[model samples]
Target: MAQVGHESHGLTKLEEGFRYTKGISQIPVKSAMREGAQALESARLEALRGRPEALADLMYGGRMGNDEPGDGYKYRGRGYMQLTGKDNYRSAGEALGLDLVHHPDLAAKPENAARIATWYWQHNVSQNAREDVTKATRAVNGGTNGLADRESRNERWLQTLTPELMEQLAAGRIGRAVEPPAPATPARTAPNAAADGVLKAGEKGPAIETLQKSLHALGYTDGKDRALNPDGHFGASTKEAVQAFQRAHGLKDDGVAGPKTLDALKKAEQTPLLSNPAHPDHAMFKQAVGGLEKLGPQAGFKNHAELERAAATLTFEAKVGGLERIDHVALSTNGTGLFAVQGNLNDPGHHRAHVNKQQAGEQPLEQSTFQLQQDTQQRQKLEAQANPNQTQPPPTRAMG
Candidate 1:
């Protein structure tokens, strides 16, 4: 009978109360209310038998007696955590500046329902010292009716809410703010960086062997029975492996180990294993696969999280097009000057575009810092990604 009123309640009324609990005691507001809502749902389901009238009567039976035929329906519980009875309706209405008594249906509105549920929790259960899940559940249920189910749902929600979001709830701050996971430490491959030049099909050397070993170690396979064998030769098998690695690590999928691709492979070797592989906010690995796309040509990202991920993985390298040579540009962690590239000064146009986009009054790369400066102090701090032990040359001029 209790299940009869399920249609009367909606998620809007329920979810909004997740952040409210102003007067509740020491327990974190979100945590407490989350349990409260889960417990209410459990009790509601348990009490549901068959008859709609009986369900309403069970929920509001204490307040609305047998004298009225439809009193239970008129003042039944409705909200994320369910606000019931005439007295609660009156108090909640007065507090929220709405006449819930005359129009009891208003309490079913998502916003009003959320406010009333939180108000009930802040006043009724705020004095309970026992923070045990069952104790909190009983505070709302009038008894520990669905303690087990409530605890289970509470845990599931806790895992879903990030600590940063929990902090906001604890502080009674409103709205949502998601923080990205911390980046893994940058890792480098074997020390043979001398032959770091671009490698294509048919290329053979220790560098090719090194690249093959990296792809196999990092679990990027060549679409065969297993990872490619680490022969010092770059063949079709090696190209397939390179492309797979590139796709996974947000790089261009050209299958050629260019300086940028080599840099990514080295950094990928260092990524730490994540606790929850399925976490929603895992770095957007496929953000610009098959090429840096908008993120490359010049280095930049959509947000701070992306920027940090890029900083930990990317390095500057000059590339040559059909007839013209493009200057290499890499951004610093602090959003400052690019690292000094070997042939950056040769292309005056590229140099001016990168060094000071805002000053030059030209459109810069997408999602990258446009202000360029030759800050000597900042350049002094820059270290080579390939060989962090050695210091690199300073940026002579800004590039776009």
Candidate 2:
């Protein structure tokens, strides 16, 4: 525990988060020297086996990679918690109105250290803090390596930081705490009202279309076999699409557009789906798309639904690996003909994607595209037969 102390009870949730994670306000200048020395010694011991180079790999993600000797010691763990790494030094400096890039030691200063740690917690961990402490810990440590220590620190600090608890402590009133409310289940609210309320399978309306469009925008192509027939209808295609989105985003794949799902959809509209910054390369991604495009439309009646579906699947696949943004899509020269379905969506990840025509089942992308195309056609035909009134016009030459 570095510079452990009590926090003011009047702090807001965000403020409390900062105090709790960063070990309260700021350590005194003289005292900070002791804390900083201790932190450096710990980091030194951890770096002893493979030297600072190994520690640099762990802290800065090999960004420096020993290219700059002594970078490991120069950019070692510092600050209220551990602002280790060149990128973090620069980022924290920018956030705190300091020039930390040149003076890395500045981040270790008592006040600067506190501000840097608080800034990191607020920006990265605050959003999910209400529901999960595990997310916050992962945000800081990258995993649950010292989860027990973190939880213990959080429990001790939080008790002193809250107004209710502080008042109880002042009055010498010690007692067991009240239990919190149970978490809400992840299911659609209404069973019958599909169009207006929870959009489930078999509901046809503008709301269903809205949901479909939202999914499509986030790379969930429920209509990948053909044009997205946001024909105001929620069928197995829509259900499967929603479930895919849920699974990718760590939600309950209930296949229902419930409030939580709807909220996530709205959030997606505002922010990119991939939270991680690391992504694949553009050229490799293009090659993978080329493979899918070569398959063309399968035994479909008309139009290139298979092509569109493949593009959507590839796009979603890239997203799962932390693609930042989609630049533009490159489609083949062929028109609406079966062979016209060649194209690639580029991202930084350089991730390769293969079209799995088996969109109706739990098949992986490793299967052949021909088999996937056959499975999709069968599922589409079954859906069409079940609802004869669901036909729609061919989609315009636009790729989402």
CA shift of 58, model 2, Å: 6.8
Candidate 2, residues 255-322, lDDT tens digits: the string is 98898888877866664222112222334334334544554443221223334444435544444434
Tell me how candidate 1 scores on lDDT: 0.47
Cα error, residue 386 of model 2, in Å, equals 90
Tens digit of lDDT per residue, candidate 1, span 87-191?
777788888898988898888777776677667667666565234556666666666543433554454445458686777789877465556658867855534
Candidate 2, residue 297: Cα displacement in angstroms equals 77
Worst 10 residues of 1 by lDDT: 364-373
**In model 1, where do residues sit more than 4 Å from their true spots?**
1-51, 62-69, 127-130, 168-400
The candidate that wins on TM-score is 1
Which TM-score value belongs to model 2? 0.29
lDDT of each: 0.47, 0.49
